[model samples]
Target: MPRTPTLSFDRGTLILHPPPRGKSWMDYATWDDRVEKFRIPAIQYRQVVEALQAEGSYFSDEAKAFEPLELSPSMEMEPYPHQSEALAAWKLAGRRGVVVLPTAAGKTYLAQLAMQATPRSTLIVVPTLDLMHQWYAHLTAAFPDVEVGLLGGGSRDRTPILVSTYDSAAIHAEALGNRYALLIFDECHHLPTDFNRVIAEYAIAPYRLGLTATPERTDGKHSDLNLLIGQEIYRKTAADLAGKALAEHEVVQIKVKLSQHERDRYNQLIQTRNDFLREAKISLGSLKGWQLFVQASARSAAGRRAMIAHRQAKEIALGTDGKIRILADLLAEHYPERTLIFTADNATVYRISQEFLIPAITHQTPVKERHEVLTKFREGEYKTLIASHVLNEGVDVPAARIAIILSGTGSAREYIQRLGRVLRKGKDKDKFALMYEVVAEDTSEERTSVRRRGVKRSEERGARSEGKVTQLEILPTKQITYGSGDRTSQRAAESSGKWDDNNSLETEE
Candidate 1:
């Protein structure tokens, strides 16, 4: 009598015993001398199973530890046209891909539709604790009967449906790799980091969904998402759904000049930094130039002076008095229209907050106070709020019609997110959102502004020229059902259709 071949899970890996006699399993497995068996990464579980089935190899699958769920949403709201199209595309892609929709376009609701369509044990990974809690609340409201648990911020309740931060998910990816049938990564751009990538690589979940407003990463690691989650199956920009699902918006750029005294000091600082760089034979134009500068700046007094001069020059460009004066004028012009003030640094945020008597939020702000500030902003108690990068993402900022960017980095994602703060359509459907970009004239800030906006313009042009607008199809507003078992049942589901402000509190994380 011969022993039966079997596949089992072990600490974020798949183990094959009595090694299947074929090249298919070998493609994904390696000989393990210690266990006298073949070991495969859990991520390749789906491919491995399919390969074995294709070759008529019989093996007992003891790796999967999830079951089909009968999930049904309590609410019966109809999905927007774009949302419907995105959901259909994801399904057509075999239920493993990314969906790109602009902020405030209801990406969360689309994930719910996916859950209903597949109805399996699911895990949602988010970048921040705030989002973890927000998803928990939404899931609880949508599925009153299903037990939704959280696994971050010191709470570790493991239920059929779990929400966790990227840190927590990555920390326990081995134990969680086999527990869920579906994995949805919110703000999926964070998935490509060195630490967080393991969460997806270790998971055996054949079904995956990545939701993000911007999928491009500065490090170019976003390409890894193809292997980790799936390809970008669907995408819709803010312009695509403008005036229908979101408010129509416009961006205005304002250039301000530094005073004579300021310009003189700025020139002196720049000259000093350039002298040091020229002597060191370092060109700031290269990709590694900045890193080289940092390394050289720490070894000697001249290097330290050069670094200081570089910092002073940047401060002059980013925080000039002329920019502050223009900000005041803009605030007065747009008085009381629910405005948000954004800056690159906390020093400028606090400066504007104090100078204009507006509330400010930074990473240093306590979580409790931040919540209160946002609540007040939503309720109209606060007309204006100032913030640094903390409000660029995750925070449920109140709907504001006007956004003023005093300073920021060259990141296109940052620019888009700041613009999105005001793009949400409010009760006044006819209202259009306005964003102002204030740049220092004849300074590096001007170039930074162009670099950020250039990427956006290129994206919009590509979207328009390629005609990526998805035609909407009406889907039935009922729970979708699929068969049981892991691989076979997943294929069956693939065939189916369906789908701020300031406040202060002192809390520790």
Candidate 2:
């Protein structure tokens, strides 16, 4: 009998001894000149093993050493219809796929269900410490008998079930690659980024699950999730669950105009920025235009000034005084209602917090303080919370029915996540969820507003009313009141008339 090829783990890669020559493995297997053997990334351990087995090639394997996991019966919780549907779809996809369910739709619970089904050593990767801790708490509570580990936020305990931040996972993916049999990515849409992609590619987990409310990215890198984790096996939008699984909802757009002095400064700054762009022959319409602008800004004083002007123009447009006034009125109109206010930048969030005396949570907020703020908000000690991008994903606040988008980017994912913060069904069965978008009229924000709403510019115009709020009723079964010209309604629409049919405002010129 001849000696058959064998596979073994070496550092972060797999070593193939008596390397298979003149075979299909040649495509992925590379000659390790130093070791005098073929090497493959540890991630391909399972793939190569299956291929060799299918080809009737006998191979001894020692790459995977993870322990099998068993879910305690106490850990099981009855899942909702949609959650069950998502899990069924994932299982049908060979337990390696993505689940696209709106936020607060119990995506985390679905992950727990997956753990029970797979019953193997698992690693859950999250994006932020807030999420890492959140998962750690949930996992520890659910699986009391199982030893859960953490690999982020200064913690490096490894157990049968593990939770880690993307940064930490990327830093240690190789060593942990063959340690888990299952991998779960929360908010998996972020997995396609430059360095983070290594976490998925370096893991040898045979089973994978990706969860996200919105899997589409502006950079189109989300498409890579098809291979990085698996295909999107199930998807449900906010609309798909409204009134049944989620609260009934409405989206209101209130337009406002800038003060005269502000408009003058904005126009001047935009003109200055455009002048530089024209002279430098930089067209922002191109894909690489922003990159070009960044590189150019680093090389010349003129470019630096142009960059400052650009920032000023955006601030003036996105943070207009008139919008602040509108926010005040909306806050009053929804007084006593649990509200979440979202802004484009931390400065704006802090400004709102200071002016309104509301609690603010930014990345700069200490973890302990942030937790205290969220706890108070949940306990009704605080009726409102203001944040810039930090609360857009995974924070569950079911009591919140009002969301005020003072300012944000045009990304649909951002808009939807913010909306989802308030979409969770509450005890009030008839409660109507509301989201107010205070947009600056005749500014670059108009286009952004349309983009964020995922509506066509022409359709938006068709529904437009001069200075009046445009209300979109998301649930067909629900009827709510925001009459066109009521006193409070007028207050909401005051000065909005200037937004009339003009749509040519440019942030650059």
Candidate 3:
């Protein structure tokens, strides 16, 4: 009888001995000098096993040291139809793939169903400490008898069902690679970056699931999710769930002009920066051009001055006095409703917090204090909450019916998430969720606002093609209007949707 091939776990990979002759697995396996044998990436464990079995070859499998799990956790509520559909799609993909659903669509419940269905030793990776604790509490409640552990947020218990932060998982992936048979990446878009990629590739889990509201990344590495997790098995935008699952919502863009002094300062700073770019023949439009500018700036005094001017110009655009005035008026108008105020930086967040006397939460906010603020906001103790990038992703605020975007980047992911913060369905179904994007007129922010809203249009088109409709309305200034710097809304909606800069809002199907 021919010798049965053996497999063993190496450093985050599987070592295959004797190189199964004439097998198709040779395409991915490489020779390792240290072991004097063939090495296979641990991620390929499923493919290798299936190939060996198809070839009728016996193998001693030791790469997977995780024990099989059988769990039937009780649930208080059943999965919704779309949630069921998402779960079924993931299952049909061989229990390994990504599911893209907008926030507040019960992704956590879908993940819970996956855990019950697979019933394997699983590790869940989240982006923030708050989310880690949230998942921990949910899992512990769902699996009352099962041993659940947390690997982050100053906790280091290891149980069959474990929740960890991305940082902690990245640090301990190698040691914990063979300990779990399933890996769940919450907010999976974060996994495709440099250091986070290690956590995904280093795990030996054959069963993987990635969950995200917006998976599109500006860096274009989101495509790598196909290998790191699996192909996108199912995707549904917020528009797809509106009215039925989520609150009816509308995105409104408001353009405001900087004060005279602010405008003068902005123009002067922009001129200084533009002169340097013109002299260096560098374009800020492309990543490479921007990178070249940064390199040039680091090497000379003129370049340093240009960098300073650029920063000042951006500050003036994002933090103009007009924006603050508009924000105050909106806050007063929406005082009866729960609101969320978002900014791009902590400085602006704190400024709004102080000027408006609203509580703020940024990365600098202590964890306990952050939780208190969220709790107060949830319990109606505070109606409005201000945050920078911290609340853009996961921390839930279900009561918010209004969202004010004072400042942010042009990234569609950021825009979508900020919009999602107030999209959760509430008691009054007839009420519309409102998003207000405040843009500085005629400055670089004009282009930035256009780019961000362009992202929304792309998603709107994508959703429309998929048989869902979302509305975008451009609201003209109630008091001040300099110029409609970018008329994208008017042009893009000309054929199908009409432009309504007037106060009359249009709700799409």
- Per lDDT, the best of the predicted structures is 1
The worst-scoring run of ten residues by lDDT in candidate 2 lies at 473-482
Candidate 2 structure quality by residue, lDDT tens digits, 453-477: 6665555544443422223222211
Residue ranges of candidate 3 with Cα displaced over 4 Å: 1-3, 18-22, 426-431, 455-509
- Kindly list the per-residue Cα lDDT of model 3 for residues 363-382, writing each as its tens digit: 88887898899999999999
Q: Model 1: per-residue lDDT, tens digit, 467-493?
A: 443121101011112112112332242
Model 1 segments more than 4 A misplaced? 455-509
Work out the TM-score per prediction. Answer: 0.88, 0.87, 0.88
Model 2 misplacement above 4 A: 19-27, 295-305, 426-431, 455-509
Report, for every candidate in turn, its global Cα lDDT versus the true structure: 0.80, 0.80, 0.79
TM-score of structure candidate 1 = 0.88
